[model samples]
Structures are given as C-alpha cells and as structure tokens.
Target chain A: MHQKIGERFDGRVLDGGAPDGMQTFLVEPDLIVEVCRFLKEDPELRFDFLADVCGVDHYPEENRFEVVYHLYSIPFIMRARLKCRAGDPPKVPTVTGVWRTANWHERETYDMYGIQFDGHPDLRRIYMWEEFEGFPMRKDFPLKGYKDAYNPFGEDIDAGGRDD
Target chain B: MTDVTILTENKKPGGGSKEVLLNLGPQHPSTHGVLRLVLEMKGEIVSRIDPFIGYLHRGTEKLAEDFTYTQIFPLTDRLDYVCPPSNNLGYAMAVEKLLGIEAPIRAQYIRVMMAELARISGHLLITGALPMDLGAMTVLLYTMREREMVMDLLEMISGVRMHTSFCRVGGVREDLPEGFTERVAEFCKVFPQRIADYERLIAKNRVFLKRTKDVGVISPELAIDMGLSGPNLRASGVDWDIRRDSPYEIYDRLDFNVIVRDGGDCYGRWDCRMEEMRESTRIIEQCMRDMPEGPFQVDLPQVAFPVDKELLQRSMETQIHHFELSAYGFKVPKGEVYVAIEAPKGELGYYIISDGSEKPFRMKVRAPSFVNLQALLGGATNMNYLADVIAMLGSLDPVLAEVDK
Candidate 1:
C-alpha cells in the first residue's frame, strides 16, 4: 500500500521493502503540505490522524532543526512520516487546521525547540510557564535552566546541598 | 485564582458578580501530582484556567541523549512511572527497529505477559482513582490491592516492584523466574472476578452513572482528530489498536478483541478500560500456553553484552567486542524510525533518527498522555460544571511527568 501511494505521489519507496522500512516518506519537504492534504483526504489514503509533531535540533551545525510528522491511516492500516528543517526562527506550515491534535503538539514543539509552525491557531507555550526563558528542549539549553535548585519533585531545598 | 468549582457553584449566591482567583495544587489531593491550575472563578463557574506544569521535568530525554541504547532502560521506567513495562517495551522495540533485530519467541511472549500485567495495573489506577476523585475511596483501595499483586509479580521477576528495568534493547535482561508463570496465572484467574466485583461496585451505581455518563464527552471524530489512542480512542468507537493495525513484536500472532464503545464519555472510557483488563487476561493466558524456550537476547555480537564474566575474562574476541561496543555503542544504520505500541494510556511511540551512530541523532517521544491532555479544556468548557471539571480531569488521565518531560 505504501509503495502504491509512494508511486502515485512520484515519491520513492524509501523504507520497509527497501531495507529502510523504519522511515517511509511520500513527498519532498517543499511539497509537504500538499502531500499531507492528499494523505488526509484522498479516498485511498485517509490518514485522518496526525499522531505526532516534533522538532529535532541538530546542534553543532547551524540551520538544522527538522520538524517531523507521524501520520496514520486508520482504514488502510498504513503509516507515513514527513520531515522539514526550519532554519532561523524555523517555520513549517501549520496542520492544526487539518488535525486539531496538532494544535498542542505544534505548540509543544515550538515551546521546547523554538521551531515555529506558521499560522498555528494558538501557538503559545502549553507546557512551560509563560515567563520561562529559552526553549528547554534545545540542545544548547542548560538542563536545569536557571533554577537555584533542581527540584523535579518540587521539594523545598537549598541549592547548596550535595550536587549529584 | 479561585477554584473553578467554587466559582461555578457559588455564582448565583454571590449575585453572579464576584471574581475570584484560586490555586489548585502542586499539592492538592485530586490534581494528580504537582500541577498548579490557576482558575479565575465568577462565583462557582470557571471563567478561565491557566495550567502551570514542569514540576516533574526530570530531563529524561536529555538524559537519554547522553546514555547508550542499553543504558536508557532505567530512565524509560521513570517517564510514565505508572506503567514502566510498557515504557520498557516501547523503547526496546524502537531500539530493536534501529538494530534490525527481533526478540526470540520466548522473549516476545514474556514481553507480552509483562506488558499486559502493566496494562492491568494502569487500568486499575485510572479506574480506582477516577472513582476516588468522585468520592469513592473504598473502590480505590480495592483497585490498589489488585494493582499490588501485579506489582508483586513484576518485583519477583525484576527485583523492583514498579519501575522494573527488565526490558533490554535486544530483548529482556533476564528470563522469567521459576513459578513466575504460575503466579501470573493465579493473578489472571483472580483478576477477572475482582474486575467484576469492581463493576458491581460502580458500573450501575446511580451516582457513578450521573457523574460519568454524558460528562467529559468526546466524539469519535474529535477523538481521532485529537490524536487520542488506546482505550480512550477505543471508548469512542474507533477500532484502532496498534497491536492489531501495526503488529509489533509477537502481537500480530496474538488473538484478542479490540474493545470499543459508541459513547465517548467518562463512563464509556471506564467501560473500555475495564473490558481491556479482561482482554489483557486472555492475552496473558494465551502467552502462558504458547510460551517457548530459546535465547532471550539477540545473538548479534556487537549489540548484546557478554552473558557471564567467564566469557568476558576468558575470550579475547568477547573482550574486544565488549570494549568496542561499550565505548562506541552498537551502531544503528543511518535512517529514521517510528515504532508505536498500544501503551496503557494510548498510542505510545518512539520516533528515532540515526546517522549510523551508536547514539540516536534525535529521539522524540509520541506520548499519548501529552496529546490527550490538550482536549481537557475543549471537553470541559461550558459542557460541565466545576465539580465535573475534576471528573473530566479524571477522564483525560494526563500524567504531568510525561507531559512535561
């Protein structure tokens, strides 16, 4: 089924049968939005679900934050993924209009990695507090940010305690 | 910020004019962990709610980046915390995909047994806790008792009751202990009847029905659109299960029903999870019957560790391979992979990218709890009262630890 869909879109059968089944693709990054529309609405490939949207920060190299999407076609029992690198304040066309689920996911990706999804309905931080600085998920972001003490459990403790 | 319930409930008595701000937890009983919800209340109705998370961000993902594929097992146990075996399985399956290896038949069966037991444990928590949120503490206690048995079974196998890092990248760390099967069988036999007892306790109880039925309603269309998975999606009448659809490990060969309900409400969700526990028992019994004997871990020299010190000390080749593998780690081919499983919460997935390095270039978790957490405001707003907000929260089952991670 992936092969047929891949062929129709003039996309290569990148994975699975080709010893690379783990990462399958159907469209190039430039044509991603259109390909996603087809995948979501096409009669044969009704992948009405947007399972996840995340950004991978490739540090050490500039201009490399790839936004990946995982889509599932319920009826056909097939899955496909799309990847796009957002350079600078990096932006990808929003899929929130297609999948409401993308709303929070895109926000999270933006909040964590500072990868913006252009035209996202409410592209605000959903997990982190409003005044928190920097994208915590970025490779460069200090693990503890700027907190005096790292208390994941929210216990009250002085910062001078033994550091593990 | 005033409690949403307080404002909503006191609106008429306060002449519908008072504005209140109340904070709910980082310590509240029903808020589920250290989550702070600042609610603006007009009497007893919540005008707006601002949720502040990150009280449990342990930087597990960041920590995963520094650890080897084999070393991340203990970290995965801490993510969901409630269902560590499922986490172990998801991460192991992702690593297996990268390694291009599958577990042995016996290993797969054992994975199934442990995962299903974890599922039952998770369901018991949600079931009992949801009821407890609605003022049924006794039912919660009963559910915990059953959960304790499941945890005991896990402890017997892995030496840790809750966060057992038994699952390994290639397969499992150790084989099932003697009489482990018998203990699982005993739990399986006793569980269904206990589940029935739980059902009798609240299934048709008027208050439970009143609190849950038609409350926190999410339609099938909305459920799918919102990326909900597992029993939450199943409860909404979508017959989508990763085990059936995607078929990871030995789940393809296993026979079990995908439970669904037409009504996508709290009650429906409860019913689906209840049915799932029963279905899980069936899978466990089948696994016990079909369990086979074979090597537990993959046979790849570069991937798996030396079984004993004898091999490591005596064999020069083994030592070299171990040193090389441990220092450089086993290299996964250059590519990307997303392997998802029907975690107790929903479709738990691991999206990994490899540049042919031992360490993953990028690792993104497709956590169902995080995605499902979005629907809370949409589902709870205007449809239910302030008290129903807690019930609605109970329904969404967001683990802040996972969400903030």
Candidate 2:
C-alpha cells in the first residue's frame, strides 16, 4: 500500500523509511489535504478512518513542529502515519473537509502546539482556555507553567501543602 | 467565530422569532462530567451545538514526557477512569511494541480477561446510567449492583477498584489470585439474568422507545468519517471492531459476535452496549476455560521488574539487575508506534515516540470518547429537540477525562 501510494503520488510523497514497523510518509504540508482526499476517495485505498491528529515540537530543529496524522483503512486493514513539518506558528491546510473528525483533532493540535490549520471551520483552543498565553505542550514551555500568570485561589488553599 | 455569529443572527422577517442561546452544562448532571454545550435554540429545538470541553484536562500527554515508560501507566489509568485496565493494556502494548517484546501466553490471557471485565463494567455503567438519565431510576440501582461484582473481581486481582495499573510492559503485575477464575465464572453465570432484567425494564418500554428510537441518528458514512468507534460506531451498522478486525492479545482465539444495530439512534447505541456486555461475558468464560498455566510475566530483567524479591537477595547477578532496572529505566529503540485496543467506549490508542530514552519523547492518546463526541457536532444534535440532546449525549457516552486528556 505504501509503495502504491508512493507511486500514485510520485513527486508528492516523500519516502519516509519505516520506523518501528510504522509505514510513515513525509508529505509537503501544502499537499496534505489533497493526499488525504486521495487516501479517502480512492476505491482501492479507502483510508476512511482518521484515527488521530497530534503535533510534536522539536525545540532545536529548524522546522520546529511536525503534525502527525494516524490514518486507518478499515477495508484494506492497513494503517499509515502521515507527517508534515511546519515552521514557527505552524500552518497546515485543514483536512476537516475530508474527515469531519479532524475538526476537533486539528483544534486540539492547534491548542497544544500552536499549529494553525489554514481552512479549519472553527479553529480555537479545544483544551486550554481561549486566552492561554503559550503552547503548553512545547518543549520550551516549563512543566510547572508560567509563574507570572500564576494566581492561586487563596493562601488558605496552599496552607496544607507539603513544603518540599 | 463566523458560525456563532450566524447562529445568533436570530430575527426573521415580518414577525420576530429570535433564537435563544442556552448553556447546558459544565455542571448540569445530564452533560456528564464538566462538558458544557452551547445550544443555539430556535424555540425548543436546538439549531447548533457547540460543545466546550477541557475542564478535566490534566495534560496527560505533556506529563507523560516527564515520566518514564513504567511511570506513565498510572497516567493512562486516569484517561478513561471507568476502564483503567483497558487504558493500561493499550499503553503497555504500545511501549512493549517499542521495546520489541511480547508478554507470555498466560499473561496475554489474563490481560484479555481483565480487559473484558473492564468492558463489562463500563457497559454496565452506560447501560444503567443512560436509562437513568432518561428517568428509569431502578435500572441504575440494578446495574450498579451488578457492576459492583465486576469491581469486586478487579479489587481482588489488582487491589484497586478503579485505577488498576495491573498491567506492566511485558505482562501483568501479578498472577490472578486463588479462586479468581471461580469468582469470574460465578459472575458470568449470574450476569445473563441481570441483563435480562435490564432488558425487561427498558428495552421494550413504550416511553423508552419513544425517547430514543429515532433520536441522534448517525448514518454509517458520517459515523465512519467522524471516526466514531466501539459501540457508537457499531450502532451505526459499521462492522469494524478492533478486537475482530485487528485482533490484539488473545481475541482472535476467543469466539464472540460483535453486536451491531442499524437504527443508528440512542436506542441502537444502548442496545449495542447491552448486547456487547453479553458478548464480553462469553469471552470471559472462554478465557477462563482456555487460560494457559505459565509465568504471569516475562523474564526480562531490564524491562520487567523481578517478581521474586528472594531471588534478588540470593543471587548477586539478580540483585544488580534489579537495582539497575529500579534506578534507571530501560531504553527503547529510537522509533514510534501507534497501538490501539477496542476500549469499552471506543478505540483507545496510544501513539508513543521513543527517542532512545527511558521516557517517551511524545505521547498522543487517540481517545474514543473525544472522537465519538465529535458526532454531536457532525450532525447528531443539529435540529433535534433540546430534550433529545440529552438522550444523544447519553447515547454517545463521553467520558470528560478521556475527552479533555
């Protein structure tokens, strides 16, 4: 299936070597929507289920973020991962038009990694507050959260806490 | 934003009939846990439903990055708190895949047994609670009573009723306690009667049928496109089940039918879960009969913790191996894998990326509740009566913890 998809797309599909038995493809961010549509519409390769969409932030890498998509083809009984790199304030075309479930997944990706989906219907923070300052999932973000933004409910709430 | 604005442009020409915006929850009992729905109502019917989640978000994915693979099991437990063992199994399988090791056959059978029990417990809650939400109070009491039996089995095995982090990377934490199989057999024997009781109460009741029969209809195509899984997807007449389609553990050896209903409504969803509980019982019975006798966990000194403390003290090599494994977790090869199991609610998947470190580089959970809940926006709730919205929400069975994870 990977070879067939690769041959079909020819120039668009970059051969991403299989890692940990996962058939991965690195496609250009611009071609993702088209590629996804092909994966869904093609009779032989009907990758119908968009299992998940998530983002990974590689702090020191040039292309800071990678949007990972897990697609499962029920008919074919095959699974593949599509990955595309995006720069800071990462922008990728939304696949919501292809898979409706992408609406929430893309929003979640946007919320956690600050990756903007270009054509998403309602792209906003799905997990964090709308006015949340920085992408919490980014490696650069501190695990304890921003100190300046911290406002405890009250001193009484912290009174019974362990000092250590 | 444009959608919200369009929805609020209420006044029609001539006589003004304005649309009223109603906030359903974040606290309302019917919305489940911390899920707030902004309903655009034109009179009594809901025009648009904007579901706002994230109230239960604990950033489990982000938190997994800072913890070792072994330490992340407890975190997975909290994703779908109702079925923690299922979540644990999914995560453990992903990590085990990364590490390139398989658990023993006995351990696999035990995992199957535990997962099926978790499925039954989760379904019992949904089957009972959804009817209760629709005003069948007796169903809740009956279902809770039965669910307690399954909880007792869990508590006996893992020593925890809810978050049974019993599954480890290579296998289960410990072997099934003495007479565990007998207790399971007893539950399996009595479960059918309880199910029949539930069926008698609501399955044919005229009021129950009226409320759920044609409400929240999701066509097969829409259900698939929306990535609905487990019973919700099955209710739409989609014959895709990870247990049967993509067999994991000992599911391939187990004989049980996948319950599917074509109604694609609240009743269909409810029926599918009820039937699935019966199927789960069958699977548990088969597991008990066919369970192999061997080591419960694999003998990977580096990956699996030594079960016997006496061996560590008796042998120098064993002590050093245990010390090293405890002090520093095992490293996985630099790669990634996405392993999913047919969780009680739906497809609970763990996508793990290992950068040759003890801790995962990135962990993404494909929570079924999160995806299945999207069906509400896809078409399930649009133009439906406000009352039907609760029935639809109940049918979808969204666990806010899984959604917000």
Q: Write the per-residue lDDT of candidate 2 for residues B1-405, one digit (tens) a residue.
A: 544455456544632367778887888888889999999887667888899999999999999999988899999999999989999999989998988899999999999999999998999988988988888888989999999999999999999999999999999999999988789889999999999999998899888888899888999988998999999999999998999988999899999999999989999999999999999999999999999899989898888878787897788988887777778777888888999999999999899888998899999999999999998884763327888988999999999999998
Q: Can you tell me which runs of candidate 2 are displaced by over 4 Å? A: A149-164, B1-16, B381-383
Index of the highest-DockQ prediction: 2
lDDT of 2 by residue, A1-164 (tens): 67788778886788687775668889889999999999888899899999999999887688889999999998888888899998655899999999999999999998988899998989989899887767889887767665443544323323323111
B228: Cα error in model 2, Å? 0.5
Q: For candidate 1, lDDT tens digit of each residue in B1-405?
A: 445566566556645686677787888878877777777766556666666667787767777776777778888888788989998999998888877788888888888889998999889999999999998788899999999999999999999998899987777888889998889889889999999999999888899889899887888888888888888888888999988887888888789999989888888888889999999999999999888888888776788886675888889999999999878878788877788898999998898778887777677888888787767647432344667677877877777777777
Indicate which candidate wins on TM-score.
Answer: 2
- For chain B alone, what TM-score does every candidate structure achieve against the true structure? 0.93, 0.95
Cα lDDT tens digits, model 1, A1-164, are 56556676654423334234634553344566776777799888799989898888887577767787888889888777776667665767888778888888888888888877878877888667676656767776655454434445432234423221
Q: Ten residues in a row with the worst lDDT in model 2 chain A?
A: A155-164
lDDT of 2: 0.89
Instruction: Supply the global lDDT for candidate 1.
Output: 0.80
lDDT of each: 0.80, 0.89
- Output the lDDT of residue A3, model 1: 58
